[model samples]
Target: MRENPTASADRDTPPTEWSVDVPETAAGDGGSDVRTSNDRLLEQYRRRSRKKSAVIVVIAALLVAVWGYAVVTGPIPVSLSETVSVLSGTDTGTAYQVIWNIRLPRIVAAVGAGAGLAVAGAVLQSVLRNPLASPYTLGISQGAAFGAAFSIVVLGTGTTSGSGPILSVIDPYLTSVSAFTGALTSTTAIYLVAKYKRATPETLILTGIALAALYTAGTTSLEYFATNTELAALVYWKFGDVSGTTWRFNALLWFVVAAVTVYFTRRAWAYTVLNAGDETARSLGVPVERTRLFGMVFASFVTAVVVALFGIIGFVGLVVPHIVRRLIGGEERILIPASTVAGAALLLSADTVARTIISPIVLPVGIVTSFVGVPLFLYLILRGREYW
Candidate 1:
């Protein structure tokens, strides 16, 4: 050992590898702090999401329940069990006939119209980024009114003679066709304006307001020139009604609403991205302008179908979407679907109330929707503009 100095020195030297000995308390505290923070954030998110979902579900359920009660226990006073039995096909009495044949169709129409309008409103608001945007706001309703009026005043008269026999042969289908054409015309005009302006939100809103006013004036002039009977008919049409809609009309409405809903839902995620900003969406590879155009066209189509079927049922499209947005975050994914459910519930309930409140003399469903929807909407607006 004495002869090998280098080996001796190596043996005497301490190990070069280093090791850190952390204090147990310090390590435990840091880990606990990190986990606590994570847990708090996650819990907060869960609470928020749960609250939102719960509110939507509760509101929808309440609406349906109240509507069901109203439908069963009206002036005619069918029992709940009887209503259920009729729906299930176990009962076939006169009561059942009344319920199944008359009330059911009206209910279906109300629900379909409500859902269609609400989704249309949501699409318009998201695309335009304007809370005020709605089916009526864009002149689609007024345009439809003009078309229907034109058919009743111009086409109907031209097609028929003053002779009772000849007038009796005039087809109602012609009026429907005219209304649809007017809706399409308005839609095309709005689309062109939106496109020419690069689909900017402000441009679309301003264009829609101008066109709506124009269409309204045109409809008013048509009404002014209409015969007394024709004016009465036009006036009734403006009030809106689901009472006379047949199953065929309901089926058509459902098909259109379903198709539009599917198309919109498919692009919902992209819509969420678009809401962040056009440049942001473009940067993320979303076709911002194209998506906006598609949304507008699809919404317009839904509005056209609804207006054609039930005349100008106002406020459903404007009110439902804003209410839904307050419950759910502004994400289109949640907003669109929620609006669909919420709108249907609201409209169905309103229709039920309209029919039952006056007993044998049913009020127009549109009147009820506007009466309830306008006050609620005003309250929301007064409370805060940013609620949407």
Candidate 2:
């Protein structure tokens, strides 16, 4: 036993090769705290998504209700029951004439115009990274105004017997066509500056400002030399009334709005990426410049169509998208559609108030929207960077 010291030491020493047996829970779950935190985050996201969906549904319902109410509330009162009956083709009387001929077209125009402009504003704001970007702010509306003014003053598309709301356009088509051409001209200018000069978003806005001034000057100059009748007609046209829009015009407007809305919805993810910043978006496989340019063009096109048809309904685009963002976060997929519906509601509601606010005197929807929009725009400005 004394001679076998090595064997004795080997028997006393522990084994060098050993393996740890990790618990299945720890291996599968990583760690309990980490797993719980991940689950909480996921749940929060889902809850937020659900809340946004709920808000959208509420807005859609509001739109329908507002539409019905608008059809009923006009110069000649029509009950909701009568409204329903007329729509169902069960009764055709003064209510039918009012709903089908006058109120329906105007109300539909408001909805379509509002939705189109609002979606355009949301897209422009996202792509340009400018919370204030809108058809009115970007000079597209002003361009349309100028085009309309040109039609009235130069093209003699409008006429008036006396200085009153009785002013009428001789050829609505020519006026709209002229307005579209003007809007296209302004859009083209912006595109060129963006493409050739490599303008920033801020620069493009400045270009818009300059174009607006140019168009305004042109319009003012035309008004200066116009006859009294022409002046009256021009002034009324700038008020932005949907009361005069025909069914044909509404059809065209809704078609454009629907098509543009679809395009925006499909490309919403791209817009969300763009909102993250141009460089970040580029890194994420987005064609930054092309997307920006196309976004501006499409947004401008929809805006142009609406303005051409309904004159200039301001702040529907600017105010609506911001309101939607506050409700749903910066998720464009929801933001675009929600803004569209919300915009329709806002404008329709405004139009309804405009009709009844003064009883006999119907205020221009443009005026009402401005009254609302100006305060909100100022508030957003005061809120500074956080508003976005």
Candidate 3:
């Protein structure tokens, strides 16, 4: 019988890269090279893991240093022991009051906001698969701004004294309530629009841009029709002040930050699998849509709480996570935790500069973060576009 030409040609063609190879070892064991290759890859991962751990430790140390600087800093420099004394309730008088009543709360709020925003940014970036998605970058802050403005100008949630958005003696957070509602409203609206349009990770960018513009217009309209008192209230609140933070507010924010961070970290492995592509993730048994939805909601919740407490601070999200990624690489296990620490450090440093830069006249931390972030983000884009 004549040989089949098609079978001959098929046999003649070289095997594809997907072809399996099972080589025998000198000891007669099969597939030793494959095992060796996998072993080598695992070793590489281990080395990288150790280095990542070291980097996190260093960043954590830096965060502690920055926190310390924030504490003892101000017009009257405080000693570490003095700070400890006030914290321990052993100290008394002027030093104690300044550190305890004012400085401590401010420091706590800055750390909480920075850490929360940064972690939120990291989660959003991972889940959305977009390098630029963050509360501030994607209009969460604008939504929050509108919400807060509505409370102050539309709902007349401004303090009864009518000077500003200060808490009344009886109602410590009349304005805060409306702001939270506004934030959640913004989050839900954006999520729904994106979902209705069947937005991919990429198309959601447009969703954010459109919503930001709409919210900004709403805020502007509110401002235009406001009374003088309401306008001043709205204006100051929009500046993103942490100085107004009470201990009660700080406790609430810290609790949210802790809860969200833990939740995100626990899901880091799923997020890592997701980076391989949704189909690959599904093959690995990941619940792609549900995880994405939960992540967005939780991240938005964290951002909303921080925004409500601190006004509309930005950039900690946009800048910190990117920097952490560049320094450490994309594995979410490291990225999430390290970003949290770096974020706290970066914001505390920024807050320090904001307080002292134009001495006796503190600028809003939001402005400072913008100044710091814009230049840095520009540099990153220009210099390391490949990294993204």
Q: Estimate the lDDT of model 3.
A: 0.78
Cα TM-score per model: 0.78, 0.83, 0.83
Q: lDDT score of model 1? A: 0.76
As for candidate 2, its clashing pairs are none
Q: Which digits, one per residue and each the tens of the lDDT, describe model 1 over residues 159-218?
A: 323532112213445655677677777777876775576765556767777878888899
Model 2, CA-based lDDT: 0.83
Backbone clashes under 3 angstroms, per model: 0, 0, 0
For model 3, residues 98-200, the per-residue Cα lDDT tens digits are: 8878778888888898999999889988887778788876777777777767776666655424554543212225545565566666667656765577666
**Best candidate, lDDT:** 2
Residue runs of model 3 more than 4 Å from their true location after superposition: 1-40, 156-181, 184-203
lDDT of 2 by residue, 1-388 (tens): 5677764678778567768733333334557775666666777988989999999999999999998788889778899899889999998998999899988888998899889989999998888777878887778888877887788788777777553664566676787678777877887787688668867766887998999898888888888999877776667767787777788888888998899999989999999898787789999999988888888878877887777666788888989999998888889999999999999999999988998899878887888999999999888888845844
Give the higher-lDDT candidate: 2 or 3: 2
